[model samples]
Target: MDTELLKTFLEVSRTRHFGRAAEALYLTQSAVSFRIRQLENQLGVNLFTRHRNNIRLTTAGERLLPYAENLMSIWLTAKKEVSHTSQHNELTIGASSSLWECMLSEWLVALYQQHKDLQFEARISQRKSLVKQLHERQLDLLITTESPKMDEFSSQLLGHFDLALFSAAQKTTKSELKYLRLEWGPDFQQHETGLISNDGVPVLTTSSAQIAYKLLQQLNGCSFLPVEWAKKREGIYLVPDSTTLSRPLYAIWLQNSDKQSTIKELFKTPLIAQ
Candidate 1:
């Protein structure tokens, strides 16, 4: 099967329009249509249900979505490995911005001390993109707060980190404190509504913990931050009686990836133990 066909199918499914998918893939609309037709012919089933102004996946398309993603990911990984000519081991690690801000930098430094010959590539991406890269074997390991839903991926509990409310101001009054909302995860979202109450919505909201940390300092607003980050910086005082949220971090990787042994070795190091 041509990977191009699957690629085109995925783009179309994502955009829900052939023309849009063509534009994104730098192909002509007619070429995109032909690819879909070729795929449908090979599969002997219609993947999409066409409409006057909209398009949706059929039951078969829904089932094929995950398979197509996995297939492409494996193919890309194989191509990468075959093209490698370096003598040293190469590993690509991806993590959310929050995780990077929290401990990945330290871990990388510790990893290099033990394995000086290894080459490392670091990527800061959101959870969804990280999952896609892992599935495609583009990333060797992922350190994130959320676990992958796919069965082909395995996750290990790294550790639990505490998030404490920090304020630049001396007073701990909720009404007087300007709030900066930080995107920890779904669990934090549900837990926060009841934990802290503000007179109005946050003056600023950000998904990146680093951004929130800086903004909290500059804007003099309060936000929940990793205990490790909060402790490093001076002038940021913990809010009195504010609830501390515990978030679990996970190291995730593809189950049968070639880098599994390397990942295990890295995990065994003191870097992850911290």
Candidate 2:
């Protein structure tokens, strides 16, 4: 099957409009339509149903979407691997911004220093996007607090980190402090709801620790932050009588990943300290 046809099909599927797909692909609208027709003819199925201002995928298209994504990802990876002339081993790692902020950044630096022959590409995104990339085989490894419960994936507990309430105010009660909620994960949310009560909405809610930290400096707000990070920064004091939460970090990757040995060897030395 021609990869170009698959690519065009994917673009049309994404935009739900042949004209938009053509514009995005830098092709004429007729060319985009022809590619889709070619792909559908080869597959012996109608990939999409066309209506006035409404374009929706057929049953076959829905089934082919995941396969198409996986194939594209695999082809891209293969192209890079074949084109690279270097002897160094390359791995793509994905993680949420918070995970990168809390631990992966320091760990990655140490990794590069220790393993000079290894090269890494980091993709920092939201958890959902990271997981989707992992599923499509764009990421060799993913570092996240929540483990994916899927048969094709395997997860190992990397370590745990402590999150404690930190405030810029020298002295203040939990109720008096403007609460800045840093969304760690569902477990953290449940744990926090049980321990703290701010009466209503939080002053700020964010997934980025950096944003929360910046706001903490400017506002008299308290947010749960990594213990080590909170302790290092000046003017960020630990709130008295606030409950500390311990969250587990996990390294997730495909069960049948070709880099299984390499991934295992990389984790032999603990990435994050418990």
Candidate 2 stretches with Cα past 4 Å from truth are 17-20, 26-30, 40-88, 126-138, 147-156, 198-200, 217-220, 254-258, 268-270
lDDT (10s digit) by residue, model 2, range 1-274 = 8899989989999999999999999999999989999999999999999996699999999999999988887888677656443523888898878778878888898888778888889998878888887787668899889998888999999888889988888767677777898988766777777455557257899989888988986777889999988788877888886888888889999998877888888896667764
Candidate 2 yields a Cα-based lDDT of 0.84
lDDT of all predictions? 0.83, 0.84
lDDT by residue (tens digit), candidate 1, 1-274: 9999999999999999989999999999999999999999999999999995589999999999999988887888788767554523998899877777777888898889998878899998877887888887678898888887889999898888888888877667555677898877666777778566656378898877778777776776888888777888877888885788888888899998777788889887754345
Q: Superpose all Cα atoms of candidate 2 onto the true structure and report the RMSD in Å to 1 decimal.
A: 4.1
For model 1, the stretches where C-alpha displacement exceeds 4 angstroms are: 1-78, 84-88, 272-274
Error of 1 at 237 (Å): 0.7
The 10 consecutive residues of candidate 1 with the worst lDDT sum are: 79-88
Clashing pairs in 1: 73-136
